[model samples]
Target: MNDYSKAARAADRVRIVELDAEIQELQARIRLLQLERYPCQQRLDAHRYPVLALPNEIVGEIFVHFLPLYPDTPPLTGIYSPTTLTHICSQWREIALATPKLW
Candidate 1:
């Protein structure tokens, strides 16, 4: 009976160790995915961002798409939604601000 109990505990310990190792592996994979995604995000941001000569209407359209839909307005503070729009640069801030529908 003692030996059987010891074996069961040992098995449980091994299973716990295996689960821990798998969690570590998953964490590493998540980190790897984030590293892989950062460049992709930058590329996407570049493509999405208007650094140069696109028309203001087009830029306004883009800003309009970034505003949040359902939240109650954030007061006259002039911040709008979809999060990433206002969180970006000065030019982006202006574009988001000027789009009449954004607020």
Candidate 2:
């Protein structure tokens, strides 16, 4: 009976070791998959934003709304100025420059 009990404990220890190795391997595979998915996740997240999906014409119209009232020249330095729109992103910069109304 003593020998049988000892054998059973040894088998349990071996199984524990095997399970630990499998757990480690599965964890490594999960990390690899997450790394591979990161860039795709970033692209999906970017597309999810409403403003980024707007057409250039609509974005141009939105820029037009940011302008100062007539006879009041938009400041070149402050956050409310057209120059700030140019600083937002490359697309905004191009749109702001092309819109003669803002200048």
Candidate 3:
């Protein structure tokens, strides 16, 4: 190759090395960010259902309101039933069963 071509090839090799280093730095930064994100994401996931954080009394009251007005009663089984609430989760089942108004 001519001197000019040889010089250009050497420059290209240097640029390629610099680019590879930059890529590695970016990848390391991404890994660090992901590591930082994980626990915060776990915390966020813990609170994903905000309603679950409410006090049992408040949740029971909310369940009471969800039923038909006082004079009417929800069915024993099916989507609208309080039994369905018992099936949702242990905490909810305990709350639903304890709340006389639900039955």
Candidate 4:
């Protein structure tokens, strides 16, 4: 090719390399942003479920209220059973187990 065409091709190749480097930098930044977002996103989602914020004592009290009245026993395993409380989540499971009245 002519000298002008050779210079133009060389310039194009250099621009291409620069653009590829920029793309790689942007991709790395995106990955970092995603990593930072994960915990914040989890916190935001946790906030959406306000019940999880209740104190353990209050949760235990709620479980007591969930039980049948005095002298009545809840089933071993069912929707209305205290075991159902244990099945809900780790926090509730702890609360239910700690509250002697539920047993």
Query: Best lDDT goes to which candidate?
Result: 3
Q: After superposition, how far is residue 3 of candidate 4 from its true place, in Å?
A: 32
- Two-way lDDT contest, 1 vs 4, winner: 4
Q: Could you tally the backbone clashes for each prediction?
A: 1, 0, 0, 0
lDDT of each: 0.72, 0.87, 0.91, 0.90
User: What tens digits encode model 4's per-residue C-alpha lDDT throughout 1-103?
Assistant: 4677977999999999999999999999999999999999889978987778889888899999998987888887888899999987888899899999888
C-alpha RMSD for every candidate? 10.0, 7.3, 7.1, 5.5
**Which wins on TM-score, candidate 2 or candidate 3?**
3
Model 1: residue 42 alpha-carbon error in angstroms = 0.9
Over 4 Å off, model 1 = 1-4, 52-103
Off by over 4 Å in 2: 1-39
What TM-score would every model get versus the actual structure? 0.47, 0.54, 0.56, 0.62
Q: Name the weakest run of 10 consecutive residues (lDDT summed) in model 1.
A: 74-83
> If both were scored by TM-score, which would come out higher, candidate 1 or candidate 3?
3
Candidate 2 lDDT by residue in tens digits, 1-103: 3666977999999999999999999999999999999999888867876676688788888888898888888888899888999998787898888888887
**Which regions of candidate 4 are displaced past 4 Å?**
1-31
